[model samples]
Target: MKVKPWLSHLKPYPPGKTLEEILKESGSLTTIYKLNSNENPLGPSPKVIEALRKSLSEIHLYPEASYLTLRKALSEKWEVFPEEVILGNGSNEVIEFLFKAYLFEGDEIIVSEPSFLMYTKFAEIYGVNIKRVSLTGELCHDLEGILKALSPKTKMIFLDHPHNPTGQCLKRKDWEAFFQRLPKEVLVVMDEAYGEFIEDEEVPLGIEFIKKGYPVMVVRTFSKFYGLAGLRLGYGLGRKEIIQELEKVRQPFNVNLLAVKAGLSVLSDLEYQKKTRELVLTGRKFLTKALSELGFKVYPSEANFIMGDFGKRVDQIYEALLSAGIFVRPLKAYGFPTSLRITIGIEEANAKLIEVIKRTISG
Candidate 1:
C-alpha cells in the first residue's frame, strides 16, 4: 500500500508526559504536580460539572450538527453574527478547516520559527510550503521578516499571540503596523489560545481587527482558560463568507454532546471565570518573582505560564524536579534548550515548585 510521500518525513507532536506515565516511569513517586501543559490549575467550573451530569442522558443523541446554541452564545458574548462563528473539536480543527478550505499543495504560509508546533505540523501534512521567520531580539514575532517572506502563493500566516512557551505578546501599535503593510490577499490566522490570560491592556484582541474588517481569523479554545481541555471544544471568528467556506469543510457533529453542554455552561459561569483569572494572575506574579530571584532569567509573560532560563542547570533542574514528582515543560523543541516553561499552578503547587527548585539548585 502506498501513502502520501509526505508521511515519510512527518513527525508526531511531542506532548508533555501524563501523571500516569510519570508514575510508571519513576515507580517511587505517588504524588505529581503537572505544570507542563499550561492547563488551568482550578480545574473545571462546578457549573460545568453540573451541566455535564445533566447532559449524560443525552449521550444517546447526536450533538446538533451546526452547534447553533454554543455558536450563538459565543456570538452574543463576542458581539458577532452567528454566521461568522465556526466551531471545532478544538481550535486546532478550525485551523485544519483553514487549510482544507484555502491551502493546496505547493501553496505557502508564513509562521514564526517557534510559534505553535501545530502550524508546521499541519503544513507538513498538507504538503504546503512553510516560511518560518525567526522571532525578534525580544523573543516576539518578527512581523517585518514575516512580511518579507510572503509571496504571491502565500495564503495564510499563523501567529500565536501571547506566544506559546515564552508568553510574549505584541502591542496594538505593532499589530497595526503589520496589518497596514500586509497584502490584502494574505489571510492572518491569530491563534489566541491564551487570550483570556492576557493582563496587559495594550495588547489587542484579534476580534478588534475582525470588527475593522481585516482578513483575519481568530482561533480560540476552551482548553486553556475555560478548563475544558478534556472536552476538546474551540471556535473561530472571521468574516461571514470565510466562516461559511470553512464550515463547509467541517465534519457534521465534530464537537461532542457533553463538550457542547460544558461550553455553554462555562460561558455563563461568571464567578468561576473570575476566580480562574485571579488565580492565574496571582500565581504568574509569584512564580515570575520567585524564579527570577533564584538567579534565573525569567521572561516577562502575560499568559498563564512563565518561561525561565536556568542556563547550564536546565537539564539538571528539570531532572531533579521530575524526581521530586513535579513536571515542568522543557523548551528544547522550541529552540530554547536552557529554558523551561512553567505553568502558573495554584499557590501550593507554585510554592512547592519553588521549594524544590531552591533545593535542586543549592545542592
Candidate 2:
C-alpha cells in the first residue's frame, strides 16, 4: 500500500511525559510532581466533579448531537450567539474543521515558528503550505513579520495567544495594528488554550476582535483553567456564518456527555474559577521571581507556565529534577534547547522544584 508522499516526512508530536512514564523511569520515587503539561495544579472544580458523578449514568447514551445547552452557555459567557459557537473534542478538532471547510491542498496558512505544533502538523496532514514566521527577540509573536509573510494564497493564520512554551502575549495595541493590516479575506484562528490564565489587563482576548467583526475564531479549552484535561472539551467562537461552515464539517456527538455536563457545571462555578485564577497568577509570579533569583532568564508569562533559560545547566538540572520525581517540559522541539517550560504547580510543588534546582546547580 502506498502512503501520501508527505506521510513519510511527518513527525509525531512529542507530548509531555506522563506520571506513569516518569515513575517507571525513576523507580522508588513515590512522590511525583507533574509540572510538564500546564495543567491546573489545583485540580478540577468540586462542582465539575459533582456534575460528572451525576452524569455517569448517562455514559451509555450519546451526547446531544447539537450540544445546544453547552453552546448556549458558552455563547452567553462570550457574549456571542449560539450559532457562532462550535465545540470540539478539543479546540484542535475545531482547527481541523477549518481545513475541512475552507482550506484546499496547496493553499497556505501562517504560524509562528515556535507556536503550537498542531498548526504545522495539520497543515502537513492536509498537504497545505505553512509559512512560519519566527518570534521576535522577546519571545513574542512577530505580528509585523506575520503580516509581511502573507501571500494571495494565504487562507488562515493560527496564533496561540499567551503563546505556548513561552507564554508571552501581545498587548491590545499590537493586536490592533496586526488586525488593521491583515487582509480581510484571510481567517485568523486565535488558539487561546491558555487565555484563562492571563492576568494582565492589557492583554486582549480574541473574542474582543470577534465582536468588532473580524474574521477571527477564538478557540478556548476547559483543559487549562477549568482543570478538565481528562474531558478534552474546547470550543470556538466566531461569526455565525463562519461557524456554520465549520459546523458542517464537525462530527456528530463529537463532545461526550460527561464533558458537556462538566463544562456546564464549571461555567457556573464562579468561586472555583476565581480560585484557579488566583493560584495561577500567584504561582506564576512566585516561580518567575524564584527562577530569576537563581540566575535563570525567565520570560514574562501570562499563561500558567514559565519558560526559563537555564543556560548550559539545563540538561543536568532537568535530569536531576526527574530523578527527584519532578517533571517539567523540555523545549528542544520548540527550538529552545537550553530552556525548560515549567508549569506553575501548587505552592508545595513549586517550592520543591525551586529547592531541587538550587541543590542541583550548587552541587
The digit string of per-residue lDDT tens for model 2 on 105-187 reads 99999999988999999999999999999999898999999999999999999999989999999999999998999989999
Model 2: lDDT of residue 4: 95
Q: Scored by Cα lDDT, where does model 2 land? A: 0.92
Which parts of model 1 have CA positions greater than 4 angstroms off?
none
Candidates' RMSD to native = 1.0, 1.0
Candidate 2 regions exceeding 4 Å error are none
- If scored against the real structure, what TM-score would every candidate get? 0.98, 0.98
Model 1 clash pairs? none
- State in Å the error of residue 27, model 1: 2.9
